[model samples]
Target: MTCQRGWQLAVLMFFPLFLAACAQTPGKGGEVPSAPPPPTVDNAQSSGDEAACRLDDIQYAVGMPLGDPSSDALARQGGAEQVRVLRPGEAATMDHRPGRLNIHLDDNDVIEELRCG
Candidate 1:
């Protein structure tokens, strides 16, 4: 009888402990590690670690300080706004490459003339 009682108590304790153990993924500073935000992203005030991102017209933040593509139709339609990721320590050689913003990305970065600049 005591053995049966012991087994029941053990089962209860074991389940909760197992679940708790599986609950949290760890990361630097115990900050509950999260995925690095998508390389391409958008923000409200046009700022942050985000790479060269589109910010209506003349105001945009290029985190790593680089140039990228902007949409033609978008520009023609007056949306002239879009941005692409330009990681840190990276650069792009852009020219009057027509409606498409032609930029040369670094080794890792690609020459993606994404509709988004």
Candidate 2:
């Protein structure tokens, strides 16, 4: 019984250290590098207002060729702050950035849905 209790105490003491070691940042000295700057699109347009990203403007794009859309195409079709094309099984964060458009595509590489986030 005493040996079992000592083993349990030892495990409790080392568990957090094990977790910390597992979570260490990769690269030199375990120091995490700063994140790179957000991507910049040359022709990305700014709608200025959250409501400015109207779904009706780009509704026609639903049946268009499926692929990553160019900033120019998005600007011409829908004047939004940002446009993201999501493919099937691809995970996207739930954060809703104003004036941002999310285009969801099916496995067949066809635009299936569009909405402003």
Top-lDDT structure, candidate number = 2
Best by TM-score: 2
TM-score of 2: 0.51
* Candidate 2 minimal-lDDT segment of 10 residues: 42-51
Mind giving the per-residue lDDT tens digits that candidate 2 earns over 10-68? Answer: 99999999999898486788768788999986534434445456788778778666645
lDDT of 1 by residue, 1-117 (tens): 999999999999899989998998777877787767778644554453324423344233222223242334324333333323344466655532222322334455543333333
Off by over 4 Å in 1: 36-117
lDDT of 1: 0.44
Residue pairs with clashing backbones, model 1: 69-117, 82-117, 83-117, 84-117
Return the clash pairs for model 2, or none: none
What is the C-alpha local distance difference test score of each model? 0.44, 0.75
